[model samples]
Target: MKKEQQEKSFTMSGEKRSKVYEEEAAYLRNRRSVAGTHTTDRSGIAFSGGGIRSACFSLGILNWLERSGMWKEFDYVSSVSGGGYAVASVLEREFDGEGSGKTRAEMVVDKLRHDDGYLRSKSATLFLLVISASISGLLTFSPIMLLCGQSASLMINIYPRTVDNWASGIFCAASAVISLSTWRMPGMVGKLTLFIAVFFGSIQVAWVTGYLPPNLRVGMGILLILSWLIVLGLLGLGLSHPLIKRIQRASFLGLMANIVLTFAIVLHLVIDGTGKTHTNDVLACLYIVSLGLIFLALLASPNRLNPFLVTYYKSLQTAFGNGRDDAIWRNRAQQGDPIHLINCFVQSPRTREEPVRSRGGENFCISRFFCGSQSLDYFRTATWSSGREKKPVWRHQTIWRLITTSGAAVDVHPTRQSPIVNGLPTMFNIGLCSWVINPSFKRKHRKGGPVFVLNFAAAVGGNSIKQKWIRLSDGGHFENLGLYELVARQCMDIIVVDAGCDPEYRFSDLALAMEKCRDDFGAEIDIPGLFPQRSPGRCHQSKFEGYIRYRGVDKPAKLTYLKLVVTEHHSMRMRLQSSIDPKFPHEPTRNQFSTKAFVDAYYQLGCETAALAFPVTGTVKRAA
Candidate 1:
């Protein structure tokens, strides 16, 4: 009995040892994965925005991927705007296999097909509303202005020249409005609406200022000035609040742009119509000089930098002044305001005679004053030096205290944050249109958003311009959509399912997406061949369909773009499939897939695209 017990105890000990060894192996593997010591074998797929078609296509592709055993391999799936619907549907749906007897992808497609289901989605309806509202808002005053200006046309005894006068007035008004409004609206759709409203409003203002007598012009101008003052006062009210600084900046930029343009138009009408410049060459010269003086005065006037540029410049200053450089220089830069440092950088070379060279690969310029051998080394590159031995901490020069600027308010530098520092002539520097590395390695949403300069091309407003701070829209407006976000997250292999509803079948959107990767993020993706502008006519055309690999080296990730093609049969099927009456929910009828049948067809088409792109051979470069 004792021998049998001893054997059992020995077997149990061996089992315990085996379990400990397995746990240790798992721990090591997990550590390697977390540390990224081993090459990552993870895949991420992203869906682009394309109304209903994108929803159908993404769902279908996901369904096909699941069947081919590739769906489970994806570590992440992301989307923007319209594509969000499909992603949200999949995430929200119950895929328990027992309920509804439908797969998650199938259920999502069905929901899109349902009249009430698809129409109920706020995103689906938002596009049309924005378009319609924009159009209506712009033309709100056009008809009334037209009728008032052409009242003589209804009079039987009126001269035929009345028609000409009305037409000319209408044209002039539209031109003036367009000129005034164009600079104010930054968004594509917003610009369109501004054009329309300005067209009508310009007509009335032109008639009042151009044709009206001198007495009437005075009264009208006075009224306009009063109205403008009231509006400005209202806008300025409570702008000092920090929470609404963004909103205030955006609104103020638009209003200021409009005000300047309006003033210019009115001045032109007054000067030209009243013969202010018709006297002689002397009058013309005086007029030109007066205009120049006005422009210079406007430039000198205190105004906010366009909010977008302000944000970018703030980021740039923070990047340079933060303690990211060598110990001595970093400490010195940190003591000074970022804007001041930028000013100094621009004026560093001072005259053309001063030589400029990198102390290394680092972004440093030779100083004007000699520090001898102390500033020659890479550790302490020659930089702009103050006369004082000890650097003073500088504060941002605030022109308008009514609104909070982009960066956080730091402690005032007693040495440099005085009138002497603030009174220096400021220059608008566009040469340093580059990004600076952000020190804080946290999510953008946390800690008051990420701190980095944006592309100069994206600025809507800036100093020396009327626009103080223009509003920007989603990344989708720029065509790259959500792909940049995925790239920023450092995905290994990015599968971009191109689902944008391009009626012309152009690849401009794809081009823009690639540019952001290459230029903005320094991705090495290259297109082997250019895509044609128009489709080959047939919905089933093979010219631009299927998957094309975008090879990436180093930081920029590899991408596989799956372009989808819709056929006549598929389009018809998507239109016929329905779950509710046409009037019941006012179902979406504008898109390619309006009904249940069309939705199902696109869903099936998506599955086919996925199958063709991702075969089961395991030969394709799987993300993992």
Candidate 2:
């Protein structure tokens, strides 16, 4: 009886043990799931909070920094710039224990106030920007001139083959020497002047030669920018001692210089490629790519972009630039070279103060409208072509051939269906780029009326303002000599955007294609005009007054073809104005509102006036 009782106790004990083990196992599994979920949520919240805090803190600091009037000091800055002035002043008191140690947010604020770091970093930065700018100035001309000399000489055109001489060891060594020696100069300005003279002067030299092929010439151009970046990188790594402010200054200078140089390099790369080759296919990255390209040396944090990867990515981008569609290569064959976009400034009355002279044609009229140092402005020398060409013969797409008829001759190739003109793409040669005189003239007003010339012997009779008298010749203001070349090269026609304004169908140059607060302002919305009834070949004359832009996403907003700008203050003043009727193929949509859309609209608009204004009419006097 005792043995049986003992056995029963043992069985009960075993069952209890089994149940406890199972319960423990279940609890452990459940805890894992719950803890994992909580951890994920916490991580996400932390990141979100940190980002918000950083942004808010940065904005507050940025506002104070901007208002501190530090930027004004740039003019007085020598090679050692004190850019960190704003941050230093704010942090000076806090660091001395005059104020509280502060919270994390407060700590960030205080860190920015630390003037020493700011000055060190900033001083270095100033030198860098100036130097890099100088380098870019020099580089812009180096290769093209070399190529031009090669192009002119050697009975045969050996320029392309000799392009390998562009990035040779000598150029790199010379760039290195200039970069190194400039740092040792007495003042930053002197160093800058030296570089600018070396570089800027060279660009003129190259432009004067005007025979180098721009596309292949880009190889050396890129290397020049890279050389500065390399020198700065080395400086940053070598200089970090506390007493070595000069080293820091040089490092910072290298970094800042590279940043500026990078942007210039990118800009020139795009412009040189586009203007000469007519290939704007590459994406323009003004900030991020530039930031990554240059600041990798001075990132000062573990969480940063890798230098190797950044280098690789830049190389990839360059490769892509070299790899535009075959069509670009084909076009290069026909165009010979790019037409430089020489910037010309003029008086408001339309006269050039600085004339855009030819490589050999020295001395240009000075135009006062040009701001900053006139030295910074660029203008192109128009190649005096007789406006005639050998008919291009290359392959074309059916769609391409259908669009243009202005070419001397467009022929389809045995290969692809894309049309070719003079052995290049027909799209450019025959594409319509129409110009029009002021299209916003109204019949009733004469007192405060827009300026109109008197006794203009134009084929299309001028709708004269009662008091004003200026007759347009070929719809040209003739302020810029380069304008003549652009018009001739582009095969532009005069477009009559407005012959007359309809009171009911009033027009404004601004396209109110999209707007905010649609429900409140829909019916009243009109396009803010970026253009006016500009005389033929007038580029963006009215855009300065006011230009409102919108995209297709604001489809609900009601916009008319009118370009409405309020000139006079009036009660219930309807500033409604109209563009030519049938403004677009259909009403503007989001698809037609971006930068790309605007360019497309421009091309399409160019086509419309070809038929309207290309037909000649006899001359007439300015109407009163």
User: In order, what lDDT does every prediction score?
Assistant: 0.38, 0.24
Clashes per candidate, residues 3 or more apart or on different chains: 15, 68
Worst 10 residues of 1 by lDDT: 335-344
RMSD of 1: 24.2
Please state the error at residue 336 of candidate 1 in Å.
Answer: 50
* Candidate 1 regions with alpha-carbon error over 4 angstroms: 1-39, 97-101, 120-473, 533-558, 566-593, 617-624
Task: Write down the lDDT that model 1 would get.
Answer: 0.38
| Reference-based TM-score of each model | 0.39, 0.16
Question: What is the per-residue lDDT of model 2 for residues 272-330, given as tens digits with 9 covering 90 to 100?
Answer: 54663432222223223334333332222111111221222232222211222222112
Off by over 4 Å in 2: 1-103, 116-128, 154-624
> For candidate 1, lDDT tens digit of each residue in 329-425?
2322111011010001111111112122110011111111111111122111123221222542111212111011111111111112221121111
